[model samples]
Each structure stands twice: as structure tokens, then as C-alpha cells.
Target: MDIIVTIFSTIIDQLQKPTLAFLIGGMLLASLGSKLEVPEPVYKFIVMLLLLKVGLGAGISVRDANLTELLVPAAGAAIVGVLIVLLGSRTLARWKGVSKIDGLATAGLFGAVSASTLAAGMAVLDDENIAYEGFIGALYPFMDIAALVTAIVMAKVSVARRASNAEIAADGTMAMNAAPKTEPAQIEGLEKGLVKTILVDTFRSPAISALLIGLAIGIFAAPDSVYDSFYEPLFRGLLSILMLIMGMEAWARLSELRKVAHAYILYGIAAPLVHGMLGFGVGLIAHHLTGFSAGGVVLLSIMAASSSDISGPPTMRGALPEANPSAYVGTSTGLGTPVAILSIPLFMALAAAFIG
Candidate 1:
């Protein structure tokens, strides 16, 4: 009972923060049918700046981090990413009225990191004076790419297996009782340079590119003066704007989500909480192994909870062309983001309860 009260109190406190308040305010405005909208170019610029700041901080920390400490949590992040998608494959993908392709696409987005959400989580942690490892931001790309590649690969494999079965049936090459076999050539073709393709596409994405550039500059150059004077101070203000934009956009996408399968709506609402807990469990293991901080655990859970809004949709569109965009994009931007943001304090509270 005390834990529950603490959780609720933490959530209420977090909700009052300007970053989240701006988000709720935007949602209210959009719900009221306001024509207020941030210009696309300006929104993109905000995202770039925020991501660069995160990357720069992480890079600076990584410059002196013990490699074992860094790699262990990173491996945990990668595992969590893969696990989220695979878990969705067994549950959401197999649910009635949900197409496998759409489910996997949605899973991919949920598993991938949200740059804006990450920035928001960092802002909230700062506001609450929760200390986390700077290298936490460096785990972003590992989880993002792993989830994406895993989902796309799984989707392609499923499609190939279906095609193979169809061909076997048409040619009467396999008995009804026997399993249909995909040709070696077909299997080879399905995976041919697939990982390489996804890595290229992910790196080429503007969000990831901005982050990587910031990381490289931080590691290679002496930009501490500019970082301290420029990025650090502006971080919160920029994050508030980003949160506002996300809230308005999430509210706007609600109609699209409504048009999809009802199962998707349920999954979107539940996935963040479930996936976040999974991440928290992984973080606990990391903590035991490397003395990872409670705040780092909360951030990891936040990353798992967040559905990718920037790079995921485009990557899904390119990689899984047959998947319905309305299902993945709408579910993610509409329901998942808000739930993830709202659940931040719950995870933080849990971290406090368990780790303290």
C-alpha cells in the first residue's frame, strides 16, 4: 500500500513538470480543434539539437567509462530490444484480427528508441535530481538497430515461409502431412546483405546521423565550452517544445488508430508497461553485475517503453512495404508515446522502491 501511494505521488509530481505539462497542454489544445501546429522544418531542427545534446553528453562520458561497465548494460539493452519484438510476435502478432506484418511493425516501433522520449526522460530525471550514467544515451543505437533488424528479419522470414508453402501446395511437391521446405537459394536471398542494409538505412536516418555526429565530435574534438554554454542550458526548453509537438501529433493520430483493429489499440496501451517492466528486470541484472544506478535502470525502462517516432516509420515503410502504416504508425504515435511518457514516474518509483 505504501509503495502504491509512493508510485501515485511520484506520477503526480512528474505530471506537474513543465515537460509533461506541455505535452498535456498540447493534447488539450489539439482536442479542442486548435489549428496550432509547429512547422515541420522547425520541429526537425529541434529534434536534431536535442539528439545531438544527448549524444554529446554520452560520448563525453564514454570517453572515460570502464569498458566492462559500458558493454554489459549495452548487451542488456540489445537483449531487451530483441525480446520485445519476439514477445510481440508470439502474442500480438498471433491475436485475432491482427495481421502478422502489422503486429511485427508495431512491435518494431515499440522496441526502437524514441529520441524525443529519451530527451524527455532525461529532462524529468534532471528535474527530479535523479543521477544516471551519461553513457546511458550511448545504448540508444544498439537497442534501436537490434529491434529493427530483428523485426524486419522475422517479417521477411515469415513471408518467405508462406511463399514456399504456397509453391509447394501448387506443385504438389510435398505431402499434406510433411513440412514444406524453403529452397536454399530462397533462404539465402531472403537474408542476403539484410543486416548490412538495415545498418546502412538506420545510420543514414537523420536522427541517428545527428546523434552519431555529435558523438564523434564529442570524442574527437574539444567542444566542452560550447557544450556547456550552448546545449546544456537550452535542453529543457527545447524538450518542452518537443513534448508539445509530440502531444499534438499523438492526439491528431488518434483517428487513424481508431480505424485499425481493436487489438492494436489494446496492444498499444499495454505494450509500454509490459515492455518497460521487462527492461527494468534487465536493468536490475545489470545493476547487480556492474553497480548500474537506479536512475540508469529507470532510463532503460523508459527507452523500452518508448515507441520510435522519428526513424521507425520510414524504416518500416522501406523494409516492410506490405505492412499497413496506419496500424504501426498510428498505434505508436497515438497511444504508445503518451502511455510511455506517463509511465516514466511509475518506473522511477519502482526503481526507488527496489534499489533503495
Candidate 2:
């Protein structure tokens, strides 16, 4: 009974907060046709600051963390990433009759992590005074890369199989311009090169780089250094403003999302919930294994619920050129994010009750 009351109280508290009020205000304004938007450069700067702040905060706490405790959860994150792609892709392909490439690409987009959403989750944790380990940021890139690579590989393999079957039907004569055949040795070399390129690109992502740099500084820099001065004052304010921008961006995309098929809408809404629940399960396991508090469970579940707006789409475009960009982008940014924002807290509450 107290759990129910607590959850309800949390919801009410979230609704009444100034930060969420700003986010809601931005959405209402955009929906009412106000042309308000944060300038692109300003938005970019805010994002950089938020990422750096998160990284620094994580680094500061990481000194006392058991690094070994992260190994299982990290591995679990990869497994869950692959599972999300498979589950989401199959549902889209089978139920919605979406093309294999498009379905798989959409899955990848939703399967990958979102740094911004993670930031929001962190804000919630802070407001509630929830305790969580800081090193979870280190697990982000791994999960992000895993989901993307799985989706790409699935799409490629599906294409190759179809091409091979068609060729076999045509008496072993490959059609012109129908996926060029390469020698086995060339294929092996290309595979190695692709892996290297992906690693380079993944680590080079702004969010991941910031996290890594922060981790380094946190591990090596002395406590109470000047680094403490910058992040402490501005973190919450920047995040609030960023959420307002996010609300505007989400509203702006609503028209585009409406143009998509109803089936796509259903898929978009359903996919993230599925991922969130599964993520909640994974968070529970991690909590038990690592002694994560209720807050950490929620944050972990939030990480699982997030779909990539930054890294997933570009990787999908490069790997699955024939994929429908509209579907992928709409689902990830327009649908998945909103669902995640609303539902992640509920998942957290659930985690709190169970763990308590």
C-alpha cells in the first residue's frame, strides 16, 4: 500500500516540478503552432555541457566503485541489446509486413541507447535523491554498438540469402548489379575493415568520448580540483533548458509521424514499452548482482528503454542503404523517446518496490 502511495506521489511530484513544467510548456507551445526553437548551436552547446557534466559526476563517484561489479551487467547489456533488436525487428517485419531491411533498421534505431534520455533519467534520480553507480555511463557505448551491429548484420545476411536464393533459381547465374559477389578472401578483409571502422566511429561519438574523458579525469585527478567548480553550478539548469528544447523537437516531428501508417504508429508505441519492461528485468538482475539501489535500477531500466537518435540512424543508413529513413527516425525520435520519458519512472518505481 505504501508502495502504491509512493508511486502516485512520485508521479504527482514530477508533474508539478518546474523542469517538467518547462518541458510541458514547450510541447504545448509547439503544438499550438508557436515557432519557438532553441538555436542549433546553442542546443549543441547545451548537449555538450550536459554530457560533460554527467561524465564528470560519474567519474567523481567512480573512485569507490568496484570496477569488477560492472563486468556482468556490461555483458548483460550487450545480450539485451541483441535481444531488443531481434524482438523488435521480428515484430515489425511479421506483424506490420514491413520490409526486412526497414524493419531491422527500425529495430536498430530503437534498440540503441539515447544519451539525452539517460541525462533526463539522471535528473530524476538526483531530484529524488536516488543512489546509483556512476560507471553505468561506461556501459552505454557497448550497448549502443551491440544493437547497431546486430541490426546491420541481420539486414545484410537477409539480403545475401535472398540474393543467393534468386541466383540459385536462375541456374547459378547472378543478375547484373544484384549485390556484387566478392571472393572469400576479399570478404574476410572487408569484415576486418568494417569492424575497425565501426570501433573508430563508436568511440569518436561526442557522448561516448565525453564519458571516457570524464572517467579518465575522475580516476586520476585529485579530489576537490577545479573540475568541481564547472559542473556543480550549471548542470540542473542546462538539463532543464535542454528538456524544453527536446519537447519542442518532439512536437515538431508529430506532423511527420502522423503521415506514417497506423501500423507504424502501433509498432512505434509498442516497441519501447517492450524494451522498457525487458530492461527493467535486466536492471533487477544487475541490482541483485551489483547491490544497486532502487534508483540505479530505474536508471538502468531507463538506459535499456532509450533508443538512439544520435548514432543508430547514421549507422543504419550506411549499413542498410535501402532502409526507409522516415520509419526509423520517426519511431526512434518521435515515438520511442516520448514513451521512454513517460514510462521509465514507472519502471523505476516498480524496481524500488521490488528491491525494497
Candidate 3:
């Protein structure tokens, strides 16, 4: 259809060139071991801008976020994403016979949702005049909940497996504080190494902080412009830091990805495609039931694959070095990363034109 082609063209314009540039730039920087780093505050600043943008965009669309009507499709997408993360990650981990830690890591990693990527999607959708609601921002928080839950579940599974195998010996028992060891079933209650790190990072990261802040602002203020004067410099700085950091992060990953190129290709590409299709279907059905737009549907699907590029897999790797972390992490990112960029523009155009 003409609409599809046009949407593809727009996505191509945004993605094809940008992704290539990202790869090339990442390669050069990574190869050179370029010290080009995003300062801590700068990273925070960028997140603030993105969060503000997401909040403003989402806030303006609140009128469209009717629970009585819109909940069906939104819930559908969530269900699909949950199934995909739960079943998909478990399937891959089991078939691969990856280490228990690796399996759990993959589950937690895959379950998480990425707000930045979704923000990019929102940007693309806006250009296309799509009619998606701002509550879309909630996807990030929702995914975090999933990631948190999955993390606990996976950790418990790993603990159980290790216990059965007698891997968590006397020495290991001492290392984990001996308290939770008396009963490994307390995964949900006691914090472990990986989950602890994730929780710390989740709160410590300014980006997450800013998103929560933005949500609060949106809730309190009518037109977001009312508080615009406060975070002026922070917002302006966010865009540049985000762009440059994106390149830097891509480069960093590309360096490590060389070893497991094949796996990355499969996981990254496959994960998003599966999620995207689910999202599209959810959007379509939502529309049929409550007249949600096609654009909204597409955006929902694209968002399913969102998660931290550096955090999830690295957390897995650090937590369980024995699982050949590269296979799961590299493959997931390699395929997901580039496609993620394109998904933003493509889904935005789809959701905006039809749903907006």
C-alpha cells in the first residue's frame, strides 16, 4: 500500500543512514579506543530532555487515554510482551542450555523496556501526525516492573539449580551473606548481586529520575511549558549528549560483538520482529474494538523490544560469566539495536497517521 511505502521511506530516511553512520562512527571510535565519553551529568541532562519531551507529548494526549475504551488493546500488547519475554527467553535459555545464571540474566534482560527508544518512536510519530496517547510513557515503568519481577524469578531459578547441583558450596554460601542461603526460595524477598546492581542503577541513573520527575510535572501542570523555564539548560544539553552517546555506546558494543556476530544477528533481529508483529496485531485489534488508530498499534508493537542496551546483557555477563554471555547479549543487541532505530520512525509514522 502507498501508506506502507511512504512509512517505509520515512523510516529509511531516519534509520538507514543514521544506523550506518552509527556503525561507522562506533567502529572508528571503538577501534581507536576513543576517550570520547559522555560526562555523567551530560548523560543525566539528556535523559531529562527526553523525559520532558515524552511527558509533554504524553500529557498533551491524556484526553485520548480513556481506560474504559483503550485498556483492551494496551492490555493486549502488555500480555503479548509478557508472554514473549517469559516464554521466549525461557525457550532460548533452555534450548541453548545456557548456564542457569545466563538463563536468568537473559530473562531479566529481555523483559526490560527502553524509554529512550520509545521516545525516539514518539518523535517519529509526531512528524507523521499519529494519534497515540501520552500514557505511552508508562510503558517504560511497566517494563521495569516486569524486569524486576523476572530478575527475581530468574535469580531464584539459578539459585535452585545451583543448590541442586551443589555448586553453591560452603565458600559460595559465605559470599552471599549466608542469611538467604538457609533458604534459597527467598528470591523475591532477599536481594542478590545482579538484581541489587540493577536496582541501584535504576535509581541512580538520572535519566530514570528525570522520567519520574517529568511524569510528576505532567500530572501537576496543565501545559508543560509552565515548568519549562526550570530545566532549560538540562533539556538543551540532553539532545546532543544523547546523539553522541548513542554513537559511543554503539561503538562500544560493536567492539565486543565481533566474537558473537551470528548470535547477535539472530536474537536482535528475531526478537524485535516478533515483538513488532505482536504490537501491530494488538494495535489493530484495539482499533477494531475501540477505534484505536493503526499508528498506536504499530508503536505499541515496536516498543515491545525496548530495553537497556548496555545494562541488561552486561548485568547478565557480570552476574554469570560462565554462560557465554556474549551469545545472548551480543545477538540480542546486534539485531535489536539497528532495527530499534528504524522501528521508531516506521512505527511512529504508522501510529501517528492512523492513530493520531
Q: Which ranges of candidate 3 are over 4 A from the true structure?
A: 1-10, 16-35, 165-207, 227-237, 258-265, 310-335, 345-356
What digit string (tens of lDDT, one per residue) describes model 3 on residues 16-126? 444334544654675688887768775655666677666655554554567755467547655654665676555655654344455445545555555656655655555
Q: Which structure is stronger by lDDT: 2 or 3?
A: 2
Ranked by TM-score from best down, the candidates are 1, 2, 3
Give the alpha carbon lDDT tens digit for every residue of 50-100 in model 2.
Answer: 777676666677777787677767787788788998997668866645777
Q: Residue 111 of candidate 1: its Cα lDDT?
A: 97
Which 10-residue window in model 3 sums to the lowest lDDT? Answer: 231-240
Give the residue spans of candidate 2 off by over 4 A: 1-9, 170-190
Clashes of each: 0, 0, 17
Cα error, residue 85 of model 2, in Å, equals 0.8
The per-model lDDT (C-alpha) reads 0.92, 0.74, 0.58
> Which candidate comes out best when scored by lDDT?
1
Q: What is the clash tally of candidate 3?
A: 17
Better of 1 and 2 by lDDT: 1
TM-score winner, 1 or 3? 1
Better of 2 and 3 by TM-score: 2
How many angstroms is residue 85 displaced in model 1 relative to the true structure, after the best TM-score fit? Answer: 0.3
